[model samples]
Target: MRENSCSEPRLRKSRLGSFSKVATTKPNSNATSENRVICIYTYDWTDVADVMRIRDELRKLGITSRIPYKSDEDTMIGKYRVRGDTRISKYYE
Candidate 1:
């Protein structure tokens, strides 16, 4: 009687090396307890400049914002909460 032998699939060394290198970041390193996060959507890379301009305008009004690398379709900007003075509609108009 003949017995069948089972063989495992082989993986390339380059593929194994690529799998070993992973991208990661520290947790909540850019967050604070007093601010709310707002995300702005952009059409493409060309719109990034306009988004940054808006960020600068917001900064002038004492509102802080940042571009988070979490997504390509949206930009994450931060806003601080102030009593009776937290608004951004005027700047958009």
Candidate 2:
């Protein structure tokens, strides 16, 4: 058994969902929509091949995310984007 373990740290996948009306019920509010959360695991790596491999692994999982993890290494810049029925609260004073 090889002892030199090269295990990548597991990323925590968080799923954002619409605000629950039951939990945050407003007397006269009409906002019941939210965005979905995605797992963004981008970081500096020692080699290029490793990053590509990791990216392929994530793709096989049938996960919906943004960008090509392999090519983006040249530009170490990553950000999260959300576009789904975005809305603001309309509370009555």
| Top-scoring candidate (lDDT) | 1
Question: Each candidate: what lDDT?
Answer: 0.34, 0.32
Off by over 4 Å in 1: 1-35, 65-93
- Give model 1's clash tally: 0
lDDT of 2 by residue, 1-93 (tens): 111111222332211111111222333232234432232333434445545555555455554564333223332443212223222111111
Candidate 2 residues lying further than 4 Å off, grouped into runs, are 1-37, 42-46, 64-66, 70-93
TM-score of each: 0.29, 0.27
- Candidate 1 C-alpha error for residue 76, in Å: 13
Query: What is the Cα root-mean-square deviation between model 1 and the actual structure?
Result: 19.1
Task: Give candidate 1's whole-model lDDT.
Answer: 0.34
The per-prediction CA RMSD against the true structure, in angstroms, equals 19.1, 15.5
